[model samples]
Each structure stands twice: as structure tokens, then as C-alpha cells.
Target chain A: MRQMMVGVVALSALMAFPAMAAEGKRVSVKGELIDTWCYFSGVMGRPDAVVGSAHHTCAMWCAAGGIPIGLLGEDGEVYMVLKLPGDDASNGGETFLTMTNDTVEAEGMVYERDGLTYLVVSEVTSNDGIPNRTHEDFGVVPGNVIPDAVVDKVLEEG
Target chain B: MRRLVTLLACAATPVVAQAPLPFDIGGSFSLVDQRGDTRTEDSFGGPSLLFFGYAQCQSICTVALPRMAEAVDLLAERGVEVQPVLVTVDPVRDTPASLRDHAPDIHPRLVALTGSEDALAGARKAFRVESEVIGEDIEGPLYAHGSFVYLLDAEGEVLTLLPPVLGADRMAEIAMGYLEAKP
Candidate 1:
């Protein structure tokens, strides 16, 4: 009888926490992409580049290039490619609407692929749709967030 | 799994032409840390362990910042006051506010700096670092930039360099060794 009660209580607890039950825990991955070049490079191989600084530059870029778009998940997982409308592009292809400020609360399973940790994202959305904006929104664009100082230095040395 | 991933990444380095060395430390630039204070070559007192990165970066920044903090704690145990200076190669993006937001998560003492593209270029050149903007693709708009921790003396001279993949203990050893040794 006591054992049955414990199991019932556990089941009740699991049902109570919907968000926790649905949303998988997220882990942040902060590094530069060292390799996996040819694979991703081909995804947007077309020479077309949307040039301009508007609110929808990323939208235009993706549309003009037909490139898949998504943000790097906090869990270091690859989220599904989000398709934004062509009208999503602002003037001059600036701003970019695809996941720009999306929080991407995802629920999924963790997997190890090609030796690296990967989270197979199931669902994603912006947390506030405003707070997640990166430094790019402020007109301060990063050539590369992870400075290639060491590699550059190494190359320079040889 | 992490180790295997790291090894594979290392082995896959494309055969690119080697670059020249004995990089410079000064050319032109200005930056600000989490405290909103401007950091120039002059502001960095004592020996500085310089790391070029941004707050938005997830993997290297998250792992390295905490490890750096732990390393600092270790150095403190040995009676050393070493500063972990982070200079953002992505100046146009990183700002005093952003650094402030990210600093607490990394380490309170982890100083972040940023400047203009010209300034960033000069600083990277001084250190001979490289980074480029990649467009959107299946993976993402990743910055295939360099990753390494640079050790600089009181005079801003390069002491030692560690790649991003190195662990905290190794970094602590390098940092503690230099702090103990007077050069």
C-alpha cells in the first residue's frame, strides 16, 4: 500500500510541472566553429548576398540566397531551420527577422554526434522576442565573436 | 565524448599556409569591461592574461570564463593577483553593457573590452589573430575566428598562449607559473 502511494505521488508531481516536463534543460555553448566547413558551406553556396542594413537584412539574405536560417541553441544544439517570409525583410535587407530575438525555448533529447555534444531540438521560440537580440542589433556587428587571434598568430608564426 | 570531439576537430585542420610571427601588442584601440571602465594598453596594470572573445559566444566563453575564474582562485591560494582580461574581437557587437551582463556568469573579475573595427584590427594584428564573418547556412552564421588565451606581462608582452580547447587546470598552471616567476 505504501509503495503504491509513492508511485501515485511521483506521477502527480510529474504532471504538475508542465514547463519543466515539456522543456528540456538548456546548456550554453560558447566557441567559434573550428571545422565542419564544406558541409555547412554548401548550404548557402550561391554567390548571392543581400547587402544592406535594414531591420530585415537577414530575411532578405535568406530569401535571396535560399539559405536555411537558425540560431545556435543555448544548449549547443541545432534548432530546426526557421523559414521567414520574403516580406520579412526590412529595407536594404537589414534587421533580419528569423530568430533575431527568439529565445528558442526548446524541448528535446541530447545526443552525441561526430564526437561533439548535440541536442536534437524539438520545439523553439523566442523568450521575449526582444531581449535575445545580439550585438548586431546595436549597429556593433562582430566580424567574428570568437577572435581568431590564436589561429592567426599560429599561421603568422609558420 | 568531449575529448573525442576535440581530437577530431584538431585533426581536421585544413592545410592553410603558415603565417609570420612575434606578433605586436599595440597598434590602436580602446575597450571597456563589465564595470563600464575604459581599458587601454595603459589601463591594464600588472600582468594580464588576455582572451579575445564576446559575451554572446556560448561554448568557449562559458567553459573558459569559469575555468579562468577557478584558475584565479587557485592563483590566489598561491598569493598571486592575476587579471583575466578579455578583449572582444567583435567590437561592433560587444559593448560595456553586454560585457556587464555576461561577466557575472563567467567571473566577477573577468574583464571584457571592446573597440571599433579599426581598433580591433590593430589589436588583433598586434597579436596576429584572425577572424572572418560567415554567412547564414544550415549550421549558422558562425565566426570561424581563432581561439586561444594569451598571457601578457605588465608591459603587455606576450608570455604564453593556450588554445581554447585547453582545460582550466592547464590554464591555471600556466597562469600560476608566470605569476610566480618574475621575468
Candidate 2:
């Protein structure tokens, strides 16, 4: 039944995909910044483990590597972050690189397109820092993203 | 079984209820191609799929370039000819000669591009894509760049941008939807 609906939508899209003005709404949301590629791809670990401090280092790599970031909203819907506050650019910048894994309260214009939600952050109202702290449980998600020398020294100390 | 049938019954991509994004995203760029021939945004005579990635990038470039190429093939099969283009972020490493050797492997018809830092910066800024040297891996200097695949017209107008995460089929479908909508 659901597949049938998708098929129907697909057919309708073919016929009437006329360009319309962009429609959006302004709202505030609280969520952790995440690497959308890893989060959606599930390449690193279980969704629960690939976030917070555990995923922080890898998130930095992914962010700098041109992967888009998203806000895993408290509502559980991942909002594709088109732009972050104070940044005129879209994909990667120091602002987003620094904010990776930090939970933030932001108000922005939200647009829904093609089964996805996009957020253009106007201002980040507050930041809660990296509070999720999955590193304690997940141990750096892939555990290899960090250099072996660093891990080896830490393990030696332990 | 029934679900697969339903998907095959309709268009190649899904969710056509889309509006043109309200961002200003296109501009003229003067870039050089693999053969060291100068090319600009208007170089492709027909519709094209453009990606911002480096030839040596092992990250999103690996994931996106092939998909963009496949999308080009898919569009060709549908009688919609679309060129696939890649503009390199690593101009120093992805020289014209290196891209000349590598571009064909990614796609027989791929137009791999490189340019002066100032010229490439203009292009990136026009498209609002950020390019920065993020780190160094064993491979050499790694860069962070924009991964969205842009659908462009002959005049370099951006029709739409597709996320790299989408499958080739979905990307093709979205391209078809926009192309077919044009007059």
C-alpha cells in the first residue's frame, strides 16, 4: 500500500514538477550537529554510537571532506543543515567544523523538499557543548579514525 | 515483489513535489579542462551535471563522481543527453595531465577541470561551495569541499542540486523531472 503511494507520487511528479517559489517557515530547534553521510550511511557504528564525543573526531574529518552536516533534532528528524549561523558559506567552514558534535539551540528557516527537511540557521541561540559523551560507551566509534599512536599511548597509560 | 513492481511502474526518481530552492547559486567560471583547453560554465552545449571534487579525493568524490557518471548514462538512455563535469578543488595535484589520465576511468566522457586558485575560488564562491585544506592523510593533503551535484544548463544556470547521498537512479529521476519540466 505504501509502495503504491510512492509510485503514485512518482507518476504525479513526472507530470507537474513545475517550479514554484520556495516555501519555508521559521522555527527554533535543539539538536546535536552530526555528520549526515556517516549517520545515514551507517558505516561507522550503530546510530546511537556514532554521535556525541565518540563521533566528534570523525565528524571533523567528514565535515572538512565536503560531507553535509545535519541537526538530529530532538524530534528525531534529521534536518539537512544548508547553512550555519554566522557563516555565509554552505558546505564547510571553520564555524561548522568547530560546532561538530556540539548540541545547539538554533532558530532558523526550515524548508521541506523531496522527503527531507532543510534548515538554514539564522542564529544559534545557545550551545550545550558535547554533552552526549558517547565516547565512554562507544570508544571513538570506528576507533581507527584516531591515530594509533594516540590510542596506543592512552591504552598504555591504562 | 509487489513493492518492486510498484517502483518500476512509475518514474525513475521519487518525490516530484519540489520547488526551486530560493538561493542564488549560479555564476560564470573560467576553468581549464583535462587537455589544458580553456572551458567556461557555458562550455557544455547541453544540460550537464557538475560536481565540485578533486581527482585524488578518496572521500565524497569517490562516492559522487561515479554516481554522477551513472546518472549521465541513465539520462542518455532516456534520450536526455547530459554531460558530467568535475571541477577539482586540489588544483595543485589534479593537474590537467593527471586529470587527463584519470578522467576517462571515472567516465568515458567526463570533463575533469582544474584552474588557477583565484579562478577556482571565484567559481566556488559563485556557487557558494567552501573549499579548504582540512587535514593530511597518508595519501597527502586532504580537502573539505562541497559534495552536492549540480544540474546545469548550457548557459551555466543551476537547475537544481542533488545531494551525493542519493542513489544514481534517484538522481537521474530528479534530473529528468527538471529537464522535462523545461520548455
Candidate 3:
């Protein structure tokens, strides 16, 4: 009888804890990886702001600065990119920095919260025919433009 | 039976866990409005759309402010009253005079707010937003901030968060749905 009671308590405890099951569906999404800050704010003021190699440098800097990256699907769905559990943090962004401004296929679990879709990327594969512009070609490194004072302010405020 | 009691507890556990929790988005804010009047969360008596951006923001704020105004007009046309509010992300630059000038251009009904850095920071914290100055130029400094159009109830609790990408019509529709659904 005690053994049965222990089993019941264990079951109740397991059930009481929040579900550890991964939220959302696992699917492959194809789109241009974008740093959502400039993408949504149109800060770059470029017609090809969020997509294409021209926006690469700006997007990279933004993503590296902890701005949430997004995948702009061809169907107009914007999937906010999130790092999967136990992913390497050596690079500020896992797949977004590497795949910025290029059309790529990303396999991930997608979660929708407050009308925003989040893509927790597991794998990334780049597509062909997208021009991978060099830093020289972009001609502007946004990282260089960020003043130390600004960085200090951000750190202080945060 | 003991087995039945155990099974019932297990079933009830998940249901309680799955129940949606309240959004902790907004709270009381003491700030100065466009006219330099002190306003709190209770200043607005009905549903209000609250967003944070700076006047100097060329990208998102430019598009969002006008869209917010449009949403207000749409709501008015439908006979649903909603206040559109702009809380400055760059309070240092967006003074009361600047906000007063800039706000009326977007919408007659729009209320632009600014305050001391501490006050603005408190408001941002209450709204769960982070605004950081990222770059500077001849024009001015640029800020990268989390941009969300928050729809609030009469008491200032966040009802829903609308993405900046949504157009005025869509925002109005969503706001109306929330308002109409309320008992």
C-alpha cells in the first residue's frame, strides 16, 4: 500500500510540473534571416533593408547586439529566431549571423506568442543564387559606428 | 478509491498548469504629457494604445505613429473610443515642447509623453521594454528599442500586444475584438 502511495505521489508531482514537452511544431522554414530591430523599424532606410546582401553588415551587428533575429518567409510570415537549448554561444548568434541577408532553409520548432512566431533553430542550410556580399562591398561596418559612450550608456542602463 | 483520487489529481494538475496567466506588461506610470501636465495610468479613462518611440526615429516610429493615429480614427468611426499615446524612448532629446510639436502632426488626439530619465526608465520597465542608444550621427543618436503597440484596458492592464508590422485597419480590428469581447 505504501509503494502504491509513493507511485501516486510521484505521478502527481510529475503532472504538477510544467510540461517539458517542446512547444510548437517542428518544420522547415525558408526565408531571409533578418535582425528584427532594423527590419521592423526601417532604421536602415534602404528599400532592400531586411533582405539581400546589402543589408548584411547592419543586420549582423544588430543580431550580435542581442536584437532578436527574424526569418521573413516568402509567404510574409515573420518568424522570430531563437537559439535552441545548449546551442554554442561563442558566436553571438547561432545561425542568424552566418545566414543574414541570404535565403536559407532552417529546420526548427516554431512557437507563436502574442502574434509573434518564434523559430528555435536546430539546423541551417543556405540556398544558392543569393549574392554573399563581402564587407568591402557593403562599404559600411555598423560596428565601427557605435560609439564607446553609447555602448557604456547601454550597459549602464541595462 | 485511492486510485481514483490519484487519477483525479493528475488530471486536475495539467488543467491548472495550462490556464493562461495574466500579462505583466503595464502598471502605474507618473510622467508628463505633451502639455507638461502630470499624468498617471488613470489619466486615460478607456482603452488606450500605448507605444514607445522617439521623435528622431526615422524608421519604425515614423511609420508606427501615423498608423496608431489611423487606428484611433478607425476606432472612432466604429464608435469605439481609444486613446493613442506615445511614450518617448529618448526622453533626453524628446522634451515636452518637442513632443507637443511632434504629436499634433501625427494626430490631434495623440498624447506624447516625456519625463526625467529615471521616470522614463521606470515607465519602460513597467512596460517591459528596453531602449538603447546604438549609434550617433550628424542628425542625432539612434536608438534600438523593442517596438510593440500595447492595447490597454481602462485600468492600464495590457490586453494585447500588437506588432508594429500590423497596419491601422488590422490594429483597429484586433482592438475592437478585445473591447467587444469584454463583458
The residue ranges of model 2 lying beyond 4 angstroms of the native Cα positions read: A1-22, A155-158, B1-13, B19-22, B136-140
Evaluate candidate 2 and give its CAPRI docking class based on DockQ.
incorrect
Fnat of all models, as shown: 0.00, 0.32, 0.01
What is the alpha-carbon interface RMSD for each candidate?
A: 24.7, 11.1, 17.0
Alpha-carbon TM-score of each model against the true structure: 0.45, 0.85, 0.62
Q: DockQ, in order, for the candidates?
A: 0.02, 0.22, 0.04
Give the local distance difference test score of model 3: 0.64
Task: Flag the better candidate by DockQ, 1 or 3.
Answer: 3
Docking category of candidate 3: incorrect
Quote model 1's TM-score.
Answer: 0.45
> Could you give candidate 2's per-residue lDDT for residues A20-78 as a string of tens digits?
32357888999999988777666786677778999999998888777888898887767
Q: Tell me the whole-model lDDT of each prediction, alpha carbons only.
A: 0.44, 0.80, 0.64
Clashing pairs in 3: A41-B60
Residue-level lDDT tens digits of model 3 in A19-111: 521236788988777666665555554334345655666676665444556777766666766553343321123344466666778787775
Candidate 3 lDDT by residue in tens digits, B1-183: 232243223322321111121224567788899899997766787889998888878756776778888999999999999999889878878899888888888889888889999998888877666676767878788776656687776766666566565668778876775676555
Q: Which pairs clash in model 2?
A: A64-B144
Highest TM-score, which number? 2
